[model samples]
Target: MHSVDHRFVELLPTPLERGVLYISGAHDIVAHLCLCGCGNEVVTPLGPAGWVLRYDGRVSLSPSIGNGALPCKSHYVIQGSRVHWLSKMTEDQHHRAQARDRDAVRGLNPTRLGRAKRLFTSLLRRGRV
Candidate 1:
C-alpha cells in the first residue's frame, strides 16, 4: 500500500487526489482513495448510526474499512494515519460480515433474534425477557 502523510483536509478535491484523507467536520465525512491502488473512492460518513471517528490529534476510525464491492476488493484499517493491511476474507466470512454490517446499518437489534428464541422457552423467566 502507498504511504500517506496523514493529512486531513476540510474539503475534498473535485477529482479526489491520492494519498490524502479528506475530512469535512461540517459534513461529518471522511474520504480517501483506495489504499490498494484500485483508485476507487472510499467514503466514511460520520454519525451515530454510521461511523464514529476518533481524532486525538490524529484520526482513527472505529471499524476497519473493507471494500467488498467489486474489482479490487481490499481491506485495511487506518489508525492515526497509518494503514494496516488485512488478509482477504473467505467467502463465508465475507458473507457473514456483510450481514452483520447490514444489520448494524439498519439499526436492527442483533440480539433480538436470539432473545426471541429463548423467550418462548421455560429457561427464560418472564422478568428476564
Candidate 2:
C-alpha cells in the first residue's frame, strides 16, 4: 500500500520521481514511475479511449493500469492518491485486456481515432507504448 503525490504541470519532467503522479492537462497526459518499484516510467494519455483522471485535492484515475508489456507487468488502480494492487493476470487475461483496449480505440469517432493512433505512435516512438 502506497500513496502518491500529484502535481499538475504543462510538461512532464524527465526522470520522473517515484511516488509522484505528474499530470499535464495541456498535453492531456499523465506520467509516473512504476509503483512496483521497477523503475519503469508509465504514461497514460487522457481521452475517451484512455484513462480518465479526477482530482479534488487528491487524484484518482479510472480503470486500472496494467503494464502487460513491461517486464514487471504491474497492475493496479490509483484512487485518492493511494495505490490499490491487483492480482497478476494470466496470459489469457492479458490478451483479452489488450483486445478490449483495441476495441475501445476502434469505438472512438474517426477524428478521435486518428488522434488516438497518432498519440499511440508518438508513445511508441518514445518506446513507452
Candidate 3:
C-alpha cells in the first residue's frame, strides 16, 4: 500500500471516503478509511489518551492504531501520511502496548492524567485495551 494522502478540513465529511484522510484540528478529529482495505471508517481523535497529530509538512499520527474489532483486525502506524503495517500482536503484547499508550498520554499531560486514566479504563472495560 502507498502512503495515505491527507487534506486538512474545517469539518470531516459525514461518511468518510477511502484512501483519503480528512483532518480537522478545529474538531480535533482525523477521519479516514481503514488502511488495510477493510473499507471501515477510522476516526482518531486528537487529544490526550487518543491520538497525537504531527505535521512536518505532512501529517503523522503517533502510537499507531490497532483495530481489534470485527473481521479486520489490522494493526499499523501512520507516520508522514504513510501506513506501516505491523505483524499481528499477541494478546499479552497488545495489553502491554495499550499500557504504553496510556502512559504516553499521561506523560504528555500530567494535568490530564485523570482523564487519560478514565479513557484507559473505559477501553479496558470494552476489551479494546
Q: In candidate 3, which residue ranges exceed 4 Å CA deviation?
A: 89-129
Q: Model-by-model lDDT, in order?
A: 0.66, 0.86, 0.73
- TM per candidate comes to 0.69, 0.89, 0.69
**Per-residue lDDT of model 2, residues 19-112, tens digit only:** 9999988868899998998999989889887899999899999889888878888889999999999976567767987898888888999998
TM-score of 2: 0.89
Candidate 1 lDDT, 16-96, residue by residue in tens: 778777777755567778888878787766654446788787777767777776367687787886888887545666687
Worst 10 residues of 1 by lDDT: 120-129
lDDT of model 1, residue 63: 78
Candidate 1 structure, TM-score to reference = 0.69
lDDT per residue as tens, model 3, 38-79: 887776767865788999878789878877653577788988
Off by more than 4 A, model 2: none
Ranking by lDDT: 2, 3, 1
